[model samples]
Target chain A: MKTAKISNPSIVLQLDGLTKKIGGKAIVDGLSFDIAKGEVVGLLGPNGAGKTTTMRMIVGLIGMTSGDVRICGQSVRTNFEQAISHVGGIIENPEFYPYMTGYDNLMQYKRMTAGVTEARIAEVTRLVGMQDALGKRVKAYSLGMRQRLGIAQALLHEPKLLILDEPTNGLDPAGIREMREYLKQIAEAEGIAILVSSHLLSEIELMCSRIVVIQEGKLVTIRSLGESETPTQKLLSISLQVGNAERAQELINLMEDITIARADALTNRITLQLRQDQIPGLVGKLSTAGVEIYRIEEVRETLEEEFMKLTGGNRIA
Target chain B: MRNFTGLLVNEWLKLSKKRSFFVAYAILAVVFGILAYAFYELSPDGLNSTVDFATGTIMLQAAGQLVPVLAVLAAAGSVTQEHRYGTIKFLLIRAQSRNKILASKYIISVVYTLTLVLTAAVLAVVAGYIVYGGGAGESTWSDFLTNIASLAVYSIVFVTMTFMIGILTKSNGASIGVGIFSMMVGSLLVMLLSRYTITKYLLFSNTDLSVYNGEGPPIEGMTMAFSIVILLVYMALFLSVSFAVFKKRDIA
Candidate 1:
């Protein structure tokens, strides 16, 4: 195996035409992506969409039939030790020896990798907010706490890339929020590239800076979240409930910058596409036209909606 | 090399932390104690038997047979429990290669087996000294040394076989079942097949290295060197198959 040198410092993870086949059937075909440092990318796909398979391949937990994954310029196929040294991943669930204390679990990993000192372990434990529970056996830990300890173990070696598959699985609302905040903090604080796969679209939208959606073992799209505004982007969906639904529909249709996507006569609801800035003027025009608007709310395009549209109504979890 | 050592230490830590190992040792200790009391009470000459005989009998029962069973259980569980508990994922994603990981596990199983056998031998010697007043003279030392050496070799065979079973089956129950079956029925099969020329090279027939020290080989023509060679061959075969399958199979 030849050692690979890093020519590009910004890109922390690179997948080049990666493919896996079993029993003459392609599980992940020609899947490719690049994750840059300090960026959190969410991997979204429907059931059996090969998301887990892709993550496993990247981590070298499962062999790929063709192609390769490069972590910090080291090819996983040829230089496994060097490539994997730059990676920390939790495939499906974070599992540890339940009989061992959380600190011992972390120590087990620390021993496997070089330069992971006692101070580093302590620092990572504090980073994951698992300092208090370090001495407790893993069997006594909650799922959220175990997830934190898993992250701490992954971070012990200070890898350039961190891959978490469903990091927020089985967590309560508060636990989910805490995890999201911690992941964001870790990405920024450590400048580590994070690739997280999750079913929670709303959480993904909040947590990830970019979304890579795949379906049927293929890349569907890669969309950037919270990008700077550009010209010629004026479509926004705004839903309205008013007393005079027919008049509101006619008024919205007559407006210059707005077009009604859908209108219900019985429910007195209207969905209009217009510029976000034009909402106030549209509402004014509606009221001036004797349409009593009871509620006017922007129908934000959630990650779920975008994912559903891209996947053609396939359910993602 | 450092990472390999670390992996071995990690595996040892995991095995040591499990309550089952301690429980197994505790039970072994109690059984040794009870056997010592029985030897003391039931002696016709009232604890006048030679220490060699008492220690020899205890060592034969514990090291020769009982410790091998414990070693089998340990070896099987060392690999199978990782899969059963889904902790194999944790090890697979580490910076070390799969070969290193598997090698560490195999080495640890060997270490654990030796430790169990040695501990049982020590406990038996202690019980012999406590029950029977005579010290272990030169003859007893030779006997104990030879017996322990043979038991150690037997442990290697038993552990390697069961470790292969664990890797192939990836289940503790299945591996233990196969191990126990081989231990009980394997010798019987060897006896029934002894008339055939090929039975001289059979694994169970060659496992008892004690035959060299006047225990008598089940087959007449088999020598100690021949049995060692056969055991080594079987060990190589079992280990090669384990590593090949482990390296190729996907961790699901």
Candidate 2:
């Protein structure tokens, strides 16, 4: 039996034309992608763009209206148990027995996963910064803390691929930062593939190595971060605090191959778009013209902007 | 087998956490307690009359039926609760086979029902003896044992039916509502249908335990041994249908 091998890059998950429908409307239409081991791939999309629906189909939670999903070379519909054993996921808000302590919840999950030792449980608990809170009932946990425990449970089996949906939804800035670092540690240290879905493209930019963007139940773009050979248009935003911002705006208008928006006196905000190489030259010219540049910082358009561009800005703003 | 045990433990943990469990048990207990008090008050002559003997046995049988009622409620949440909470995905991704999960749930539910029935039967019997001061009431040990055995079979059948209900209906509210309503109204419906003699086989009419006087013809054509066999067959049918439906239903 010749199976489709996705190369030696340690392919953890692959979805082929996964489609789903509910109530006479298609939710996910022919979605496909590949996630490699030790890589964090962000599933970026709008609220109803079918990212979560795709994840659900891949994990065998929802049946596909058509198409297939494979994890670690095992087809979910054909070899469900074998395929699913390599997958760990927390969809939407992670839930547990509220009456039970976080440790007890993990213990129950540990009982179902094979070859996961108690020591491993302790390790993941510490990794998520929940070791001190492991003995507390989940009912008392903040949403961020519960999300950490959710991640802990997902890692308990040391699965080949981990899928988390909107994990940073309710987290404060510090908690979100901790989750970003902790997820990186898991991917790098354990060599597990991670697929995270989020509306925060800045977070995705800081984490994922590759990303799949979905728009209205269809694939918009699949691009690699910091690498891969796709040369899409480069976008840049500039923030300036200067003398006579109107004069600076006049210079920006005279320049070719750039779109500029000037700030009002009340707001003091300016946004500019130009080719990657042109940004420094424009900044230099503005500095030489005695604009008394309080600050001229170059801003790279985040995954969020790229996504908006790819989908023609039809996403939920 | 390890996975089976794990699923069983999961089901037990989940069932124990439900609020309906405590409420159901409390209601059943109050009903039984009221019956015990009434038996003590009405049989002031200490059940010396044959009429008192018959009524006391009927009440015991009524309590026996609660065994099935509680079993249905207890098993009702097995699948539907997970579906409601959107945790079926978590369970599906576990390292256990779906077949094992369903089987473990069925076994644990039947065990729960049987234990409840045994407790209720023993309590009712002790209460009956205390209130009526029986001389074994013209019944032999073999006859009493046979009745207990028959009730055990009935309990298994009811548990299996409840499991099927959980599988057939994808919502806890629907499954529990139907299971309880069936236990209350099923016999009446069956009797109505029994205008055609073939429908008599469908009714769980073996509940008329008072008719077993240890010397009579065992209630027309009813035999505890035969009832046990028929109930087992019915249970097997319900189980097969439930498994098939669960295997085919979409997880979402």
Candidate 3:
């Protein structure tokens, strides 16, 4: 796949060596990435992996110890007003005055920025599907509604980049799915860049076009879901059902480039890791060795397993 | 300048929507009504006392003493509520700088306090006329103007003090505690310390500016000009500390 160049004018957010240190330890170390216009990027990391810290630094909620963040070509440190005007974000929970209506909450944000008209407010309310609930006080709304209102407020000014920290947090499965659909619609319809941090991997896999993974404050990998690479192209664990599990395990030990990931004796099933192309050859060898194979299936890796493997078995919070 | 105005408007909108904001005015109305009734019972003849209870000057004097506590409550909540509700993050993320946001909150708080004071003063005057059956006092219009001006200055000092406490503590309870302590116990503390030369410069002592209207200074040898200068100094100090702390600290 072709990587977008640095000179790409569509880049809305660029972080060059962003770093943050607290109490003489680096919480986010030398992090760098760029988000293009109309791109939806997911920030995937375990708890305390510095996703929120990076988001905070981007939004200027906290000072960066080193490096810089540029939004729409304006430096956050030097041109805070101009740079921040081009960006909108919710750092953690999207909090508002509970006594105020959703419209009033949006109005509060509206008054702070320039060129945000009543029409724009109405447009965003409709965009978030919050038009009917705008009159209701925020305290009466559910968490999903609040999140939608928060998105409406963020988009009122038509910012080039939108940053959301755990936008799907505390959401039920249906609510999470709804939020994912809305986010995709916003990104595509408005041509706005979005940077979302979340622990829900399947949601991230479905919602994000690209993913940036970090572990221990360092960049683990950055992958694009849009690429055509199949799951078989990457290392995979395959589960095998056989007539004789013990004999199959011994036969598998004789095979090159294959190792037992897990073994189940009573069920006569074994999980092995190898290249996908070698599965057929392994089966053939096992049958020749008189170990009858009942079933052979590729065990697709869930995002959880891949994340745990990348982070050395650390769970994503 | 537009952003600052917008911030001020936003703060006012939020405050106006709260039940506490209107309840405060309601409390002021009740206090004024009681004061009017008490004055009517004490001077039924309306001619025995040299001081005319019906004049705006008297109203200013009454509110000057009582309304600062209300100002303290309002000003303390201005900053502390945002911190308590974790809503400061929303404001901090805007294009406005921290200082600009804080300045807007501070100025709106002062304006809200002044509005409360003016409303109470007006209520008192109206009640006074209905009870005492007099239109004006023996004092000149200039004396009444000075009284109003001095009351404004005095109330602002308390507002600024409470605002500083709110920013420093970022907790509604702590801000209210300090504000109430300063309003209630402050005078007693100043009275106990009045023997010392520094007592003349204490904030509570300088805050009662009715001395210019012949109400007598809280301390001996304290002039109106001296008290004005002291209050201005303290106001500047409080504002400077508030801005410095707010600007330097990170929003949690």
lDDT by residue (tens digit), candidate 2, A54-103: 88788777788887888888888788888888988888788787777888
Worst 10-residue lDDT window for candidate 3 chain A reads: A1-10
- Model 3 residue A147 CA deviation in Å: 1.2
Ranking by DockQ: 1, 3, 2
User: lDDT of candidate 2 vs native?
Assistant: 0.74
Q: In DockQ terms, which candidate is top?
A: 1
Tens digits of per-residue lDDT for model 1, B1-252: 787789989989888988776876776688778878877778644334355644465444443477778888888988788887788888888788888888999999899888877777777778777876664343556766788888888778988999999999998988888987887787899989988979988899987777788668888888888888999999999999999998887886
What are the chain A TM-scores of the candidates, in order?
0.91, 0.80, 0.80
Q: How many backbone clashes does candidate 1 have?
A: 0
Candidate numbers sorted by TM-score from highest down: 1, 3, 2
Clashing pairs in 3: none
Over 4 Å off, model 2: A21-26, A172-174, A226-291, A315-317, B17-60, B128-136, B201-233
Identify the superior model by lDDT, candidate 2 or candidate 3: 3
Q: Please, what is the whole-model Cα lDDT of each candidate in the order they appear?
A: 0.84, 0.74, 0.82
Better of 1 and 3 by TM-score: 1
lDDT at position A175, candidate 1:
90
